[model samples]
Target: MSEALLIAVLALPAVGAAAAFFPDRAGRLFGTVLAALAFVASLLLGAYSQPASWFAYTPAAQGAPPIVPWTSVDTPWVPALDLRLHFGVDGVSYPLVVLTTLLTLLCCLYTLWHVPTGGRGSTLVALLLVVEVGMLGTFLALDLVLFFVFFEVVLLPMYAVIAGWGGERRRHAARKFALYTLFGSVLLLVGVFTVVAAAGTADLVTLTSGSVSLTRNTQLAAFALLAIAFAVKSPLWPLHTWLPDAHTQAPTVGSVLLAGVLLKMGTYGLIRVAVGVAPEGARWASPLLGALAVAAILVGCLVCLAQTELKRLIAYSSVGHMGFVLLGVATLTATGIQAALIGNVAHGIITGLLFFLAGAVKDRFHTGDLAVLGGLRERSPWLSGLLAFAAIASLGLPGLAGFWGEAFAVVAAFERGGAGWVTLGVLAAIGGALTAAYFLRMLRKVTHGAASPAVAAPPLPALRVSGMELVAWSPLVVLALLVGLVPAVVLGLSAAPVQSLVEAVTP
Candidate 1:
């Protein structure tokens, strides 16, 4: 109800990270205390938000109320460039802020005993809280420069996690991750500057309300720069080469955030920036974006099929899932945008769950190679069952989170047509089949056989799956069912934003 929520949301973790630096094992205790309070505050904010504008596609009463009053905080920061430090959220930002906080807190829980016992554990937890602050700020920022600053803040901690605490090729993977992302950030800065210079203001609320259009040539160029930046984060094909290595090297909590909230930043930016500000450019670039989307789906699926490593396979599959989100955006319709929006949330939860479980399995077995791990069902029925369930959901099994986004995107594609859209849709459908093939194969290989030697973990007093693990996984499983059964839980709140975006971009 007040800006205090925003300040507290960002500050709680910073306080925890600072407190963790004490000479004792206070990092874990500080993280727990602060994480719990931050999560609770976020929840209270969600429950206390005001009502939003209505969308006819959804019943008026169904959407989530604003997570706080639709309040904007602004003060002169870089007055030389007419930039102000501004931040606010409407319906769109509400859910994602809650998501970032929710997952950060959950990731904190998962790390309590789950982090690598001896090596850089405190630093990992502290960095994670910093990552949370960055994600929260990115979603809530109302100024382009502010958004960019917060967005970049996320890079350091993530790079450190992968490079410092990752697997065998941590340095190489971290360097590649930094290079690819830094390039994108450069382009993103160029685009942000272009918008500020051309439009005379960088406040998102004002920019959305202002009907200023860049020249078609300018629009196309700027959109290309901006879109590519987002795509790299989205890890859309070609630009996605760095993701597998990064994911493979990252710790479990790192992978969860990467697959979950971090990747969504790109797709979110494309809709919020490119289409929202440069509708003409979006229309002109539709065919190109569509082609890239379908291509990414096919290429990602193929990679998934060929991967022998479990984490690498899951990372590739994200490339495929995100392709579906991009494909939806290319259609430039309410349904398409809605599909992208809701699908992003679904993919985040389900895939985040998979990575979390994958890390658990790897900890138990000391490996993530499919050929080495097997019959997890026999060894740990609970873990095996959850893995199978997540795999099914990933493959778009009905009555689950995965089905809504893919199905809706396919429908959106079917409903729209222009410049080879038909072909794009056809290829995407085939990609969908490939998705099924890879996930099914993964299930067969990892959970179906007798417990293999690779699955044998260190003989440290049989690590019982603790109550805390249940506390972490139970929400994911319930959320999978909740969203699967009642997707309106998300789709409803997102409808207004989706419609607003489509109307802005439509011819």
Candidate 2:
């Protein structure tokens, strides 16, 4: 039954992608329903994947394999290359899988009401479903070769979404986004084959479990290649130039998914693949990784402080937010990994809503320039309130979803101990302050004071929030509060798997 659910979670989105081309509104309606069903399947998969014995299960013996999927489907796909149709769900991946489905569903529902000008709503929905399939497959794939296949699958569909349904500069943004990620894809391909060839197996479970021994040199090389590849996707530091452009020009749903689950792919792979597959490499590179992560935090916040465009500010914020996630992973401790995991989920929730609100602002005012927007509270109280809530949540308010991840990442870095790690931790905490400053700056400019020309130009009635917007934004708002208040929602599920992985990797 669990296996069937796993298969269904994947199949539903795929079917929706095909059905989404079936004529007019019917296609969109069908797609939304299918997305909803896919989300339901993901939730059920989580429920079923939990062990029946739960508290009674014992830890694996020392030097034994750590990866034990609660539910998995293993079958031969290509006997010649030793590749198999291997997929599984466990504590580590389940939350991300569920996140992908939920975000896709919200995006689809948003599309049903307001299709961007560049293409048909049906096509946009179809492409979203395709992206969903790739993301879910990435999270669920347990074979190294298969993981690469799914990872590559996301590039074109997302490109189509941006290029076909995006803003004035969409084509250039789409092209740059594709080219940067494709470069990373090449590195990823080389890294995957390197590990597979050296280890004589493509099974991620086998490779990560310490059953296959890789020399230090090979592990170092593979980890570097994989880390850079994932970093490009995470858009870490110098490699992140493409992201602001992509987000600035992408349609609302495109920005949401890009910031939401798409970026998580990189950080997720860094943890599950790079760190898990090459612990020695991770240890060797920890200082460098942590340093770059803090750099991203500070740089992203500084850029956001100077940003003039609304969407662009939000885009830059993702860089800093993801920096926190990466910093947590760089620590290489159970607490750090747990912080990274919850941070991943919290960023998805808060940033997704921010993009949604940014899109609404752009759509209504016909401008995203912070200099030209003001007095949101006077013209549209509810919209202003939602924007305020999203911005506050994004700035890492103590009781909001964004708080735990950033705060814990700092705590984890301190927990690691050492002058350099301690410095990185202090700098990251300062970045947290910078985060609050920029977000508050954004809110004051966009929501308070006298009305700017752009804000005053839009009729008050026109600024009123639509029902469709409410439906799309409500879940994100609730999730920000829920996850913030009860961080255990993500942490509880991941604790054991994270402990096992940390133990396996620790010298």
Candidate 3:
């Protein structure tokens, strides 16, 4: 039953993608309906799915407990190489799966009212569905080769979306995006193969369970490969140059999904693949990872302060926000991993809202330049109000969803036990202050000022918030508030799995 649900969650979007070849209205309807069904299916699976193994495997060591994959599905696809089709979701993966489906559904709903300026609405929807398949499959996949296949599957469709439908510089951004991530893919492939060669199997569950003993040196080398790959995707500071370009160039829905589900893939990989399978390597690398995370936080915040374009600023903010997530992972404590998990979801919800608002602003003013976007409050109260709300939430205000992740990450870092981590924690807290500074500056510039000449000039179509826009954004707002008020909602889901993961490495 669980495997069937997982398959439905994975397959429905694919089927919708196929069905999207129909004419525009029909295709949009079909795509949205299918995405909605997948969302429901994901929720049901998370609520009721139990731990169970779909494939029979006897432990190599006598008296060892059998390893069961939650909501697992397995099938033999290769014999000689021992690769197989395996998929499952644990406590850690389930919320992200739900998040992916929810955001995809909202994007599809938004399309119903506003397709990109391009004519091929059907093709656009199909590309989104394809990206959904890749994201969902990545989170659910339990085999290394299968995970890589799903991971790579996300690249081309996204590139097509950007190149085919993005802004003036779309072509360059798309090409750069493809080149960077593909290069990262190469590193990931090498790491996957290295681990497979050492373990003699590609089963993620078994390898992470410590069934395959890996020496410290091998773990470090393999982890380095994997880290570089995931970092490009998670886009830790130096590797992050491609992201602002990609986000700024991509269309509204494209930016929404890119911020929402796509970025989580990298941090998810760090937890699920890099750290899960190579704890010793993780321990060795935690300091470096934490340092890089701090750099991302500081750098991303400072970049935001200097940005002229709203979307570009949001893009850079993701770099800083994800830094918090990465820092949580680097802490290597139970609370830290849990903080990373919630932070992943929080960044998704909060940043997705920010990008959506940024797109709306661009749509209204025909510009993303903050210099010309003043007096949003005078021109459109609805838009300005929402923008203010999202920006405040983003600044890690005490009761909002953003606060818990960074706060806990700082706490975890302080408690991570080492002089170096204590220093990192202090730096991270300073980064949080920088986060507030930039966001407050942005809010003042965009929402609180008199209308600039460009904004005072009448909107092209008498700009007002549409019903469809509200429909798309309402969930993000509510979830951000929900998670903020009751963080336990997200924190609870990953606690046990994170505890177990911490145990795996604690020795």
Candidate 4:
């Protein structure tokens, strides 16, 4: 385990994306096979890779640590500006990297089974592989400039996926999504430069692992820039307007990955970049962040109650679920950060399942409007049951993956109360209750009652759940239950890393 494994993990997908330009049949096969290969390579990297420095300039001061060496590939690219081509994974980012690969693999499988209308399967699969590379790179990049490059790499492919292969208003949604995220990327770039300039280095590990420090003003300014950038990506509260449109218009695979992996990048950035590099700033701004988190929770639930479209409803639900994760970050404590990490993974699994089910329902009944769809249980009990199960999981039902993150977040807030965090905790609890209310409302409207004319219309084939759908969704379902029953699976991985983060803030 050297850099060979990490290089293979990234290169295989890039190669796959390029190969997907072949003839349609061959391209699709190559895409899926290559994505599977990349996923395996990532797993191997997780298991066998050791801390190694691919390239680094020795520091002037004796006994100082190099730019990279902690399960990373580090190579000098711009010594004058202190930039490096660096990639690494620690406990905090490892699970997310794995989740990205897993979800991309599943999306490829789903694409093979049911290619979305209005696009070539090969193109969609190729774009998905590219997105995987960007996501994995974001999670693993150990230098701020390198991280920003990977972060921006995801933008174009996702925009094309939406605009080229989406529903009505696709272009508008794609443009909005692109513009919003691009604006954030600008802020992120500026913030990265500000931090690098202030700290005299661009290595994320060096700055964040507490080797560098900045003045209070620099910390505050940089964190402000970075937080706004991350917030737009997180789509917190008012800034979150782009998410519903994007999710509603995007194709099934697009929606799944958007909700599953893309959104986590924002919250993860808050933890890794904003707090990790600007601890004092994080403490200074924690109150405002906490308030916004509560606002997102409440606002999302209220919107979910009013949403008629299934995908739109699920999209709004993400805002609320992510609020818990953000609140955990705002708490800036180990327990809270662990909750944030678990919540991030749980949201990926549970919301990915919800989006898949929503897509399946839309495909069958040809409508996602709650008023026009009902009695799915009578015709497609399995699909209906899965939808119900996903809804329960989303509602934070006990013994499911969604439960622990939300519960722990509230507990952390209550324990770490100050400057209205207690109020934030109470409001979050209400959001959780509202989460149940709207989910139950959705189930009642779409899963129960008399079959509306659309559902009962004659000549409609009784659509059974497809094998590919099961293959894509079953892992999420099982993982949700597994994590719920034994949260240590996720929490255990992030605990040590999050504790380190907590110390950064506390010290």
Candidate 5:
């Protein structure tokens, strides 16, 4: 039943993508239903029974495999390459899989009511479904080559979404996004073959289990290739130039998915593949990685401070937010990995809501410039309130979804205990302050003042919230509160798997 659920999760979306071209409203409704079903299937993937104490913090027994998928399906795919149709999920990946499905459903539902210009609604929905399949497959894939295949699958469909249904600069943004990630994909392909060639197999479970011996030099090289590849997707520091442009020009749903689950592929790969498959390299590079993550945090916050455009500012914030997640992974401890996991889920929820609000603001005002927007509180109280809530939550307010990952990331770094790690922790804490400052600034500029010319302009549609918007945004709001109040929602499931991974990588 679990295996069937896995297959259903992937298959439903693929079929939906195909069915979405069936023309008009029928196709759009069909796609939305399939997306909803896919989300349900993903939820069920975690429903299988386990030992009563499976969530306990006890270490794995000696000689046990670091990763044990709760449900998996494996079959031969390419004999010559030793590849197979291997896919599985454990506590570590289940939350992300569910996140991908949920957000895709929301995006699909959003499309049903409001399709962006330059494309049919059905086509946009189709592209979203395709992206969902790639993301789900990437998370569930247990074979290295298969993982790479799924990773690359997301690139083109997302590119099409941006190019076909995005803003004025969409083509440029789409091209830049494509070129940047495709470069990463090239490196990713090389990294996959590097490990497969050296290890003589493509199974992630085997490679991560320490059954295959890789020398330090090989590990270092493979880790470099894989880390850089994932970094571009993570858009770490210097490699992140493409993201703001992509987000600035992408349509609402595009930005939401791009921020929501797409960036996660990189961080997830960093934890599950690069670090898991090459621990020696992760250790060797920890200081450098930690330093770069700090750089991203500070730089992203600084940039956000200077930004006038709403979406662009939010886009830059992701750099800092993801920096926290990467910092957790760089610590290479159970607390750190678990922090990173929750961070991934938290960022997806909060940022997805932010984009939804930003899109609505842009849609109504026909502008995203902070200079031209104000008095949201008076003009549209609910929208302003939701925006304030999302922004505060994003700034890492205590007792919200955003706090756990950033706070725990700092805690994990401190726990690592070297001078450099301590320094990274301290600087990251400062970045947290900078985060608050920029968000407050954004709120003051966009939501606090008297109505701007744009806001007060005549002939504008009523500021009243639409039912569709309420339906779409409510889940995110609830999730931000829910996950914040009960972090165990993500951390509980991830604790055991994270402990196992840390143990595997610990020298």
Candidate 6:
């Protein structure tokens, strides 16, 4: 039964996390095997599993529909107010659950040989496995309290990775990252409690099935708390200050996963929790959200043009890319919503690759400073080629995975069923142009240049790209090409769900 799959999907990495603490070299091998199995399982789930099986999870409530959670697993640890151990998965969660599993496995595989953690490779691998549990649970939990528990569970491990295993400023970055996310977590907790207190059920499925009404004031207030929490996680615009520092400081695998998968949690929360549960509030706030998105895109693009540090430039690019996701949500249309979804996946893969190459560049030449690091193309052609490909992809080059998300987002913005959305579309188009310009400039400086004297002069042999590194990275690159060359794969999955969401939100 699919229920069994769910248990394995979550439990497998967890089991690995535990085994990974065995304090031996086999810890890495054990973790790799477990992670690989989970990744394969996730692929099976996404490619072949039926939605009927996925929605086996049904939330319990008095006003709910007749269908029950056919295969839920719960344990009663508290009965005073009806909170207990609860776990489930549903249609809305299908893609994310699979993504979390797939990427975590890749991260585990990547860390096995290429990690830069402070002589604590096994411990770092264990932490990532633990982080996987929190990620999977966050996407699948039906109960509000359970969701929050999983949501907050990821904080400490990530903090340790950034602070304990990070670069020179790791500790400072860790502190700042913890403080920012914790601030958002507080707001999210308040919002979750408000929902439970008012609606009397922490069950998301039940809330989705029926209608719940609250006054405008309460809706707005609760919306702020929930949206801010998601936004901080998404690291949208002003609250986005934490991400660049975190990315700049974390190791390559950490940066790849952080940029690729972790940030999607925030946007996923925006759609799954904020808009899905708080439609009225979402409608009220659409205009303002649109404006902030536009500002982020513009600001993110402008800042990228000024960056001499390669990683920081891409870090800022995340700010711009997420602006598109917010813009899609602000529109509240099927097309716009789908654009956001596709954009989320695209950015994760493309930017994740970018970080990978950035780290590789650092590892090769000993600096990500664009100034000192000239002629990587000559010194290391393979690294140069990979960086170029990812750079083009990140800038939304046509016929690649990045193009569709930005292109349609602009189209949706123009026809986003409102004047506000139209404005966002225009601003985003400008951001797109800026994206192209900055990336072209970046390519010139890093990947396509005359070698410095050292690079041009003889005796220094070019750095070699390893086989395992290729295995670790090529999947994302291939996907970026697949989605770009054949966007239908992504579009087909998102179209129906987005249609449902847009119909619900449209006035």
Each candidate's TM vs. the true structure?
0.94, 0.98, 0.95, 0.95, 0.98, 0.92
Tens digits of per-residue lDDT, candidate 5, 1-507, equal 888999999999999997556886778899999999999988777776243343445555666776888889999898876679998998888889989999999998898778888978888899999999999999999999899999999999999999998999999999999999999999999989899999998899999998899999989999999999999998789799999999999999999999999999999999999999999999999999999999999999999999999999999999999999999999998888888999999999999999999999998889999999999888888999999999999999988999999999999999999888999999999999999999999999999979998988734356778899898899999999999998887887777678778888899
- Estimate, for each residue in 240-306, the C-alpha lDDT of model 3 and write its tens digit: 9999999999999999999889999999999999998888999889899999999999999999999
Q: What are the clash counts of all predictions, listed in order?
A: 1, 0, 0, 0, 0, 1
What does candidate 2 score on TM? 0.98
Q: Which residue pairs show backbone clashes in model 1?
A: 49-66
Error of 5 at 350 (Å): 0.6
Query: Candidate 4 residues 122-183, lDDT tens each?
Result: 98899999999999888888888988999999999999999998999999999999999999
Task: Report the C-alpha displacement of residue 181, candidate 2, in angstroms.
Answer: 0.5
- State the weakest 10-residue window (summed lDDT) of model 1: 60-69
Worst 10 residues of 5 by lDDT: 49-58
- Candidate 2: tens digits of C-alpha lDDT, residues 1-507: 899999999999999997555885888888999999999999888777774433243444555555678899999999987889999988778888989999999999998889889867888899999999999999999999999999989999999999998889999999999999999999999999899989999899999988889999999999999999999998798799999999999999999999999999999899999999999999999989999999999999999999999999999999999899989999999888888999999999999999999999999999999988999888998999999999999999999999998999999999999999999999999999999999999999999998888888977788999999999999999899999888877887777778888898899
CA shift of 75, model 5, Å: 0.8
| lDDT values, one for every candidate | 0.81, 0.91, 0.88, 0.87, 0.92, 0.78
Task: Report the error of model 1 at residue 45, Å.
Answer: 2.2
User: Which regions in candidate 6 have their CA more than 4 angstroms from the true location?
Assistant: 51-79, 84-91, 453-462
How much is 104 displaced in model 4, in angstroms? 0.4
lDDT per residue as tens, model 6, 1-507: 666676787888888886546664678778878888887776665544454333233223433332133345566646887887666553446666766776777777777667685756777778888888888888777677888888898899899888867889988888999999999999999999887777787776665444656566766777888999999999998899999899999988778778888888899888877776677788999888889988999999999999999899999999999998898888777667777887888898888889888887777666788776677687778888988899889889898989887888788778865676676788899999999999988888886677865445444443787777788789888988988987666666555445555555555
Winner by TM-score between candidate 6 and candidate 5? 5
Candidate 4 Cα outliers beyond 4 Å, as residue runs: 50-70, 458-462
Residue pairs that clash (backbone atoms under 3 angstroms), model 6: 400-484
Please provide, for model 1 over 56-157, each residue's C-alpha lDDT reduced to its tens digit, 9 standing for 90 to 100.
244323232212225557789877767787877666676677778778888887776766643656677788888888888888788888989988988988
The collision pairs in model 4 are: none
